[model samples]
Target: MQVSVKHSLPGRLRLLYDKNEYTSKQALLAQTLITVQEGILDTNCNTNIGSFLIYYDTHIVKENDVLNLFHALTGKYLEDPELLKNVDQIPETESIESVLIETLAIHYLKKWFLPLPVRTLLLWKSLLERCFHVLSKFAESKRLFSTELLDATAITVATLTGNKNTASQINLLLNIGEEIEEITKRNSYGNLAQSLLSADEPVQVVEGMDEKTVPASALKKDDVVVIRQSGLIPADGQILDGEGMVNQSSITGESIPIAKKAGDSVFAGTVLEEGEIYIKVVQTGKETKVQKIIDMIDNSQSLKAAAQQRSELIAEKVVPFNFLVTAATWFFTRNIVKTMATLMVDYSCAMKLSAPIAVLSAMKESATKGITVKGGKYLEEAALSKIVVLDKTGTLTYANPVLEKIYAMEGFTEDEVLTIAACLEEHYPHPLGRAVVRAASEKNLVHPENHTKVEYIVAHGIASTLNGKKVRIGSAHFIFEDEKIPCPESLAEIKKQSSLEGYSLLYLSHDGILVGVIAIGDPARPGTSEVIRELKNLGLEECIMITGDTEGAASKIAAECGIKKWISQALPEDKVKFIEDEKAKGHKVIMMGDGINDAPALSAATVGVAVEGCCSIAGETADIQLQKSGLDNLVTVRRLGMGLLEKINENNLTIVGVNSALMLLGIFGVISPQMAAILHNGTTVAISIRSMQPILK
Candidate 1:
């Protein structure tokens, strides 16, 4: 791909490339990759003019960096040809103006150019298609009620009155309205699909005994990719070797960093918080699983909100009344023109269309802000839930934990215990692990990995052989009760002091003998206290904390966040039971957490919100997935969901108020049937376009 610099500024650059050669999908893929890079503030790739524009911070990025990046991308794409498999997710949609003009022009051109009989047959053929929907629906219920049946009645009345011209105009307007609605909806989905675009980059792969760097897209099934600290895991794969603490907040919605090791599965979009691991690729691009889920959500009617479902039911119920109005006009006045006027106003049409239109528009607006709502149903739940349950670890505190103190047993110096602990913890880069490793590094302690074949039992301690002696390190339960290692008498004093100080403990035992203890302290994340206040201001009735941590530690974090209710030392089952109990009491509970343990509770909550750094299980189980970090977006989502419901209500009121006036004017001889048809369809089209407009900034 040959390129030339079109222009350049201190912090901006534009390059010209051949659109005819690269294709729009390739250009978009290139843009997605560039946008995610640090220091590149913005990117605008206008495929129309083949110009790629980039804005950056002059201090952070250089002009040569931009050019070199693109040069490297060219070879990377060649290595993995299917990198663009999900790039073309959004289909091109025609503007409403184009659809309306084309529909009207096509409808009239046939009437003018074709012979009388031919035009008549074509018009009836089009009208019959509308009649077919009505007949098909009526077949199921054995009744003449539906929005489609009402549409057919208007066309039939126009023809019976010997007004073929009115009939043709009516059909043409319906066709135009339908086309505009279809285009509007497709545009909504297109906007959302843009948010799911793949941001590909190069990654390190292990071959033989050495590691090689390759494009993320170049990875194939069974490829062993080495992910280091702060590197994004680029594919869904199982860890083949090594261990690390993974922060999945950006992808799986985990609240804190999770420990990953050999045999553990890793997902793409999760950051390697600490350590390094070799992963065997299971899937790439996240399109096979995610794209299909999005498809299922789009087509599944069961996922629609209750209000949307009610609007459909209301639309169908009113169709029968539309028939009654036409019948009364004919029976009392014996006026064919008045009957036709009532026929022109199909009251149910606008009601049904506007509801889903509002939902889709709100959903599209949310995607821009990095909120992935699975369905409209959850949005509604966000508004109604008052009792909010928050997970402590990653939600209230940062993943970065600090090693405040180390209490070595008698005869062992603090330095000796720290060195030994860091050696074992270096493999797992989770919050606590990262803290231990960092502490050792800051002290210039040289700790080498001399242990052989360490085993990590999840939710327990790690066991391995060190210098021909068995060693274990983890929670007190893992070291004492689980391993049956007796604790030293002095350790009881340390435990009492640590618990009162609200510090989490890590116990280390060497060769069945208790050796030392380490204390880890956590600070509240910036603005967490304020976010809790904001949630309360937004009508959250009560906020509570549930955790597996000791009561003292959980209480300290909960107090920092102003949470008064809590249940500590709870297992995964306990969290679920808490949510179910709240729901049973008729309280709408919103649960937020990010961990494997949180998955069941998330499922049992009235609305499950998976915060940043979540595991795959929690992300998949939660009702909503926050793509970005922090609780600010949780506030944004709650507002957005509430806004959607309000918009739908306002739209319903407008549809009813405006169309009812049009119907009255038509029946009372104030407007002709044709004029009523024009106004009625115009109102429907207006509301639909309004619904597609932004609900949030």
Candidate 2:
């Protein structure tokens, strides 16, 4: 690669380079590297033009120095960390095992291949590195005691006492332990990153009544694509035709596949597990929903649980204690070897390494089981939450409603009432509205907009004027109570029977009088009852259902799902108040919801779980998103939460117990400094490796 200056200024220079000399990726890398240098303030690179513009401080960097910098990238300099320092998000290509093996190879090669005098001198470099780290840490915090300080003291003492072999082994063990713990924690991210979309894959699109294949980059907004069985969805798009079961593990972290049909949404990176679907592309590439999931994983460090932070704080605080033990042992026994043993077994190192590895590893495992935990704290919260509150519409009744019965009053006909309802409802997105409209459409009832302006009362009903009289349609609370429409005595029995059957009733009225009743069958998701029972088996304290359905319908569904407690005719605010009330009573609540109305309550609960969707509704943006179509993933999340919390506690206890035993054995003079160091680091590596295992069966 070659670089040259095409134009120059005191503080700004326009540099030119051969386009053939470097790839576009290398251009961006060069730009990133140069921007972080002391004098270079900013840089803009146009790989297409084979040139870059640099803005630098002339007093700090000269034109000659800038040209010399570019010349240094001629060969074997691209992977150098020194060149990329302070530049963020650069991909790491080096493997942890390779680093460990290389370090080990270097350590042993000097001892076996080199003569004693030369090998002994090489050991000082390792001692100096340890001593520098110890001093630098103290310089930053003004603290005399730390894990690094302990290691440095022990290593320095061993070397000064003519124990070069012991000094080298101690540093090698510490280096190996650090590498192992780092890889253990990082393995989760590596697995998660594997699910990122394969951007270069081709997709099939509809063109002029025929299907044709095109690159994913060729797809754009509103373009229709056909996905077959076992095909990967290339973009975030809505289904326009056909149906299939989409495996959303890549996006929602759940392995369960969801059935999709026309008018349903599908996301990029999700596989069409079964059947097929024709999708109208909404967004593709980096803008897809799966990309967002990848972004979330990339930033999960910021979402560390309270438990993880506390363990880390305790780890730091315990450092001074280790030093105190070492100082006390040396003063009383007057034995250098005994002093080195206590210093070798560090409590802080084990706790600090294992806690985050446990939390992150558990999170990674949960994603594979189809639950995306937004924060480690939420998993901790899930482990402790006693109550589970579920939203009704999408939470309990998983799909759109179907119009089951139309009861017309004496003055009107059934078709007339259905037409009026459908005309008004076709404009809204609610499930019941869709049911009414769909029923009307199937019967070939063309009910266009004949009413005046429609007024929507959220969680209540719709109101409008039909030829000058007031027409109302919604829940029993909306029409009969809020709108002051009187219920006919003759229809009381029918209303009671409808509710008992678990069918949501939509009441219609005109001019303050009852006109008709529409019973909508919003069935419970398959195996919902079994899921609730299983949750109870998992030690859930209580399960509560909240909905805007009539009392009879709410009661029947609750009973069928084995949910003992329920709140009917609930508005959005009522949901929020219920969660707050539960919190006030000292109970931790897990709120599972699906709609936009459920946002507040989801946030109010101890841990918000979004189900059957990617975000809030999990894809709807909840703390935990169940990407699958049912509530069974709830069982998975609960198991994972409890498992993670338990594992973390178990690891902490094991670390303390093992390290304490090591310190005792050392104080008794049963082990050398090398043996003490080996046992201590071995415990840390073992605990970290165990923490990285799946917490769930």
lDDT of 1 at 566: 89
Say what the RMSD of model 2 is. 15.8
Error of 1 at 50 (Å): 6.8
lDDT of 2 by residue, 9-111 (tens): 8998999888776665576556655665668776767655778888889989998888777777654655544333312222223366687889899878777
Alpha carbon lDDT at 484, candidate 1: 95
Question: Each model's C-alpha lDDT?
Answer: 0.78, 0.76
lDDT of 2 at 585: 100
For all predicted structures, in order, the TM-scores are 0.81, 0.64
Task: Report the Cα lDDT for candidate 1.
Answer: 0.78
Rate residue 24 of model 2 by lDDT: 59
Q: How good is model 2 by TM-score?
A: 0.64
